[model samples]
Target: MAPEYALNGLFSVKSDVFSFGILVLEVISGLKSKGFYHPNHSQNLIGHAWKLWNEGRPLELIDICLASSCMLSEALRCIHVSLLCVQHHPEDRPNMASVVIMLGSEIALTHPKQPGFFTKMESHEAGNQSSSTNEMSITLLEPR
Candidate 1:
């Protein structure tokens, strides 16, 4: 979750950008952004990615399917770009235009700061939760 939206309930373009970042990571890692488990890390996917990135092992986040086919530099570039999108503050996140440019070029990317809402959920806690309010259970709305 974007910190502002998660904490204050204000959604904006940047919030969408934040979601995009997590989705990108999810696709690359073959894991859910939230409730991702690894006995070794005991942290969510975002935190795990950050940890691996700092340790110069960002490629470990790539799913095995992609690892076999994807180029090392390209995969690392995607991870780097995703991290920039998920920065702790909306202002810190690249605008869509910047993101597009960043993805298309080999230009140096600014190192990403820690991401927001990065935390662990033990298996029991993670599995027992109900759907979030942000989810729309039904197609249409009704007047209350």
Candidate 2:
């Protein structure tokens, strides 16, 4: 979920863009954003991707299965566009049309600003955490 929608129940085109960015990352990494655990870090899949990107190691994010089949430049372009889609501010994110153009062309992409909702958890804190996700659910039906 986009940070604004998750925190304030607000949804918009930009929120959908955020979701698209996550989906792109998931496809590239072959990992789900939620329940993503890294042995050496507490960052989720998005945070991990962002870190690798910032460190000039974005290619490390590609799934091993795709290494032989995918074009490296195309993969890098997708990563760049995905980052643009997930900018911290809604106004900074491009519309769907712009995103489509970006993906289809070799236009130089602007550097992405920090992503929203990337609060880092202390490694120890992450390990000591319980199963609560801070979300509540109500069960209305009983098993037959």
TM-score of 1: 0.82
How high is the CA lDDT of each candidate model? 0.84, 0.84
lDDT string for model 2 (14-126, tens) is 99999899899898888887767777789877788889999999999999998789999999888888888877788888888899999999988899887876666777666
Residue 68's lDDT within candidate 1 is 92
User: How well is each residue in 15-101 modelled by candidate 1, as lDDT tens digits?
Assistant: 877888898899999988654777675677888998899999999999999899988898899999999888879988998888889
Per-residue error at 140 for model 1, in Å? 19
Residue runs of model 1 more than 4 Å from their true location after superposition: 122-144
**Would you list the clashing residue pairs of candidate 1?**
none
Write down the lDDT that model 2 would get: 0.84
Report the error of model 2 at residue 96, Å.
1.0
User: How many residue pairs clash (N, CA or C atoms closer than 3 angstroms) in each of the candidate models, in the order given?
Assistant: 0, 0
Q: TM-scores for all candidates?
A: 0.82, 0.84
